[model samples]
Target chain A: MTATLNIGFARASLETKLFFRQRDAVIFTFSFPIILLVLFGSIFEGDLEGTGITVAQLYSAGLIGAGVMGVAFQNLAIGIAIDRDDGTLKRLAGTPMPRAAYFVGKLVSSLVLAVIEVALLLAVAVLLFDLELPTDPGRWATLVWVLTLGLAGAALLGIAVSSLPRNAKSAAAVVSMPYVLLQFISGVYIPFTELPSWLNDVAAIFPLKWMCQGLRSVFLGDAGAALELTGSYELPKVALVLGLWLVGGLVLCLATFRWTNRGEG
Target chain B: MTTAIHVRGLTKRYGEVHAVGGLDLDIRTGEVFAILGPNGAGKSTTVEILEGYRKRDAGEVSVLGVDPGQATSAWRARVGIVLQTANDAAELTVRETVRHFARYYPNSKDPDEVIATVGLSEKAGARIRQLSGGQRRRVDVALGIVGRPELVFLDEPTTGFDPEARRQFWDLIRSLAAEGTTIVLTTHYLDEAEALADRVAVIAKGRIVAEGTPHTLGGRATASARVTWADGYAETDTPTALVRTLAEKYDGEIPGLQIVRPSLEDIYLDLIGDAE
Candidate 1:
């Protein structure tokens, strides 16, 4: 077990280095969410109706959710699919490396990227948009669980969805279609207050909605609850939904994960 | 000698297509064995089954004494597989990639030594993507041997290599075989088999049509030789007699006389063609 963990850490370190080495991927992954924040945050000038918070602050908080998903889900799903297509997974499968260690490596690397992504988003939020960091220790505590649960669920789902793409060429399109749709319906692109009830129900079933709501609670505090679809932050439901995804993602990953492309078989 | 690999009645099918059908083989320890075949002749399938990457339908098989279907990590540690078309880890340097794979094995060769063995010491620090096709292939070889495996599987290991690189690769395989590593190579190049393999098996239509030493395969050593002179050429079992007759025809010196036996390639074509 110790040996496996050591290898996993080594894999993680290597994965992280490789992830950052690709300059285009690094720039696009980190900059996309920040760009969205700057674009939408700048265009929508005023505060939410009756709330003291500016529209940009709400976007700053929500884009953090999108940023995490980009780092964990989009990057991983595309990254893993590319590995599968390019024969990385197949080569590793022939080795003595523990299969579980590969997942550990992926999860650890995604977590590292997520941390850096969130920090950059927060920096953008605080510096440009005048968004306030939560003063309460409890809100900070809430941030920990939300970030943990959110990243875990997204990363695992990324691994699961990686199997859906037929090959590396189609990976980005296949992974991003649902992701872009989720951003729209999950209150990242459009606020929960403006979205219809039916859309909320659909979005509630997905982890991104709850993740966005959880982050909003951290950044927006009690006053921002007025903008929530439920008129309050449903923290327990957030935990339940994201937790369910974590388990479901693991099951799907086990079921669908393939070391080689189908054609190769 | 102990058998490094043994198989009997190995069968595999993909839906309606029989990729491997009732194939049998035995590869002995410390011998360089080559499987020669045209495309889609079950070469990759058979190797993958031995590598534990593909399931066989029906077979009694063993590799290094363990059934490959139920091979443990320790079994994997003892075997090295150099994949044919794996173009991954483009961002990683050759040294980093070799070092990373080395950690997977309990007993591993020094990364620098493996890199040098493949003649990539100058490009060790270069990222894999930056290397030429032949250089990239050398990296693949480096990764395969870094584990110091007792047995190595090379699936078309030198397909895209230039002549010089191919010769260098053959030397590497020879050195490894000298060190007592049992090597199984699959190639379309008959000369590669001739240059490296102690024994060669030609697979055609999902079965081995011929198997023997490079010289003796398909009766190549004993096949009738062609005696050629300025006037004509004749296929004869008694090439010496034919040459003597030609010498008499030339009144003591045979004009443009040559005795040529059928090449390994001719035997290979005959075997596969006959099988088809």
Candidate 2:
């Protein structure tokens, strides 16, 4: 078991290194969020309505969730597709290392990268946009749990969605499509109050809305809490929803993941 | 007395196509066994089933006393596999790849020693993407044996190798067999099989059509022998009788006379044809 754990860690580190080494991926992962934060901060410098919080704070929380989703879901799905196409995953399947270890390694790497991205985004928000840290320790704890659960949900969703991409090139478009639509409806790019009523109703069914709402409760308090459909900051229920999505995502992944590229054109 | 591989009535179907159809084989410990056939003749499917990569639809298959379908970590660690295509770890050097794979096994050989044994000592520090095809093949070999496995599977390990590199690879396989490792190899190269395998099985259409030692496969040894001289040649069941006639015709020493039986390639092609 110890040896297996070491192998898992080694594989995870190697994967993380590969991710960071790619110039475009690194720029998109680390630098993209910062760019969004700057753009949103400049656009909404003063006088934002609907919710009591400033536009910068609302956008900051939303951008953090978006960045985490990008790393944990979009990056991972594309990576797994490429690895499958290149025969890396199939070769590893023949080794003594367990299949679970390979996925666990990927999860670890994605979570670690997500945490780093969140930290950088928050730092930029505080220094440039004059954002304040949450004063309540319990609220900060809630934020951490929200991020953790969101990461788990996104990672599993990535693996599940990767099966749609038959080749490495198609993987990018496949994984990014849902994310783009989710961004539009879940208030990542636009304020939730500004969206159409029907689209907002549909967005409520997605895990992203709950994640963004949960994050808002931590960072923006009661005004943001009122925006949640539940009308209460129920951290435990949010955890349960994310947990269900994680389990559902894993089942989807197992059912659809392909081990060989032989039959795929 | 122990058998390294025991496969009975193995069957695998890929939807409408049958990849392996009721194949049976027994490979003894410490013997180099080769499976030879044309492309898409179920050679790869058989190897994959034995390596525990693909599941079988039916049949009992065992490798080193454990069922391959139910293979465990300990079972996997004891078996080494060199697949047909080399997986790329472009950022990693040859030595790094070997060492990384070593960590997967419970009892692994030294990475540096394995690299040297595969004749890649100088190329150890070279990144995987920078190495030539033969050098990359050497890396694959290094990774396969780094676990110090008792049984090794080489799936066309020398597919892209040049003549000299192929010969060197043959020697390396021979040395491994000498060290008491049971090797199961699949190759299209008849000379490679003849050089390394103690016994060869010819498969066609998902079944073994012929199995025997290299020299005696498919009645090759007892098949018609061609007695040739500088001028002409004659084929007969009794080469000794033909040679005697040639000797008498030439008055003692037959001029440039030589007797030849069917080569392994000829017999293999005949066996495949017969199966068809």
Candidate 3:
């Protein structure tokens, strides 16, 4: 089992390396979030001071979710779809490598990339936009757990969504549809609290809203005291919800994922 | 010698279409066995089932003495497969790709030695995408043998190769067989089947119509020989006697006279029924 795990890890690392080497993946995964952060930071500069949360804080929360979505959903769904179309998945299925190993590798790579993206976004927020870092270590720990669970949820969602793409050309459009719409509904672009009550209720059912809300509780500190959570960012409940999403997503992915497009061809 | 592959009543289907309809075969150890069939003839489905890639709807298949559907790690380690299309690990150099695959097996051959064995020593350091199609095929062959498997499956191994490259590949395959590796291959080239296979099977629709040595497949050896001369040709049971009579009529050797039996190509086409 240890050897099998190592095989999965190695394969996942190779996949991650391949992803980073692609010019478009690199540009969108790393640079796109940073650009959005900078753009939003400048636009919200004057309005954020009165609310006691700087523009950078808002940008950091929103863009971090965006970064996770980019890697976990858009990156993974399209990547898997293309692999299926190209016969890569079928070839690997013939090998001794277990099917679980392949998914494990994708999960590991997406989580690692999510951590890196979050760290970079926080650093930029702190340095350029004068956003305050979390003061309480316990809160910081809770924030880490939230991010971990949130990323897991997103990755599973991505794998599940990948099955919708019929081929490589249409994969981007299919995978990106839910992601783009989620950005609007889940406060990745607009804050959830400001959205109408009906929209807020709908967005609450999605893991994305919970992820951004969890992050807001971490960074905004006393400003989030009025929020109804009982503890540090409501970590336990958020973790449970995200964990449920992860399981549900995995089930959907396994049921829908095709090893080859032999039917399509 | 032991039997390398033992398959009986193998069956597979795609919806209502039977891809492999009750096929049975046995390949002995250390021999080169070839499967000949046209496109969509269920050859690939049968091979895939034997390789543990596709599950058979109904059959008993034991490769290296273990059922492929319940294949263990040791069983997989003992089998090597060269697929029709090359894997696209374009970013990795040929050496890197070979070396990466080596780690999967328990007792893999040295990567550098495998590269040299496949005649790809010079192209080892080049990225996979940089290599020509034939060179890329060499890389696939290198990866397939890098594990030192006891049985290797080659699916149309030289499909797009030029004449010289095909000959070189044939030599490589022969050398592997000479070294006691059991080879089961499928190819469109009849000459390749005739030259390399110790025994050949012709598949049509979803069943094996004929199986034997290349010369004797479909009674090809005893099939009426064509007696030809400069003027005309005729099929007869006794071609040597016909040629002798022609030589006597000429009072010397008959000009351009030659007796020839049906080639493997002729038998194969006839068995598959002249759809070409």
Q: What is the DockQ of each candidate?
A: 0.87, 0.49, 0.42
lDDT, residue A234, candidate 1: 94
* Candidate 2 per-residue lDDT over residues B167-244, each given as its tens digit: 988999999999999999999999999999999999999999999999889998889988889998888899898888
By descending DockQ, how would the candidates be arranged?
A: 1, 2, 3
Please give the distance, in angstroms, between residue A3's alpha carbon in candidate 1 and its true position after superposition.
Answer: 1.4
**Candidate 1 Cα errors over 4 Å, as ranges:** none
Best by TM-score: 1
1 or 2, greater by lDDT:
1
Query: Chain A TM-score of model 1 versus the true structure?
Result: 0.98
Residue-level lDDT tens digits of model 3 in A19-57:
776767677778888888998887877534355677568
Error of 2 at A155 (Å): 0.8
Q: List the pairs of residues colliding in candidate 3.
A: none
Question: With candidate 1 superimposed using the best TM-score fit, by how many Å does residue A75's alpha carbon deviate from the native?
Answer: 0.4
Candidate of highest lDDT: 1
> In model 3, what lDDT does residue B241 have?
84
TM-score of each: 0.99, 0.92, 0.93
Candidate number with the higher TM-score (1 or 2): 1
- For residue A221, give model 1's deviation from the true position in Å: 0.2
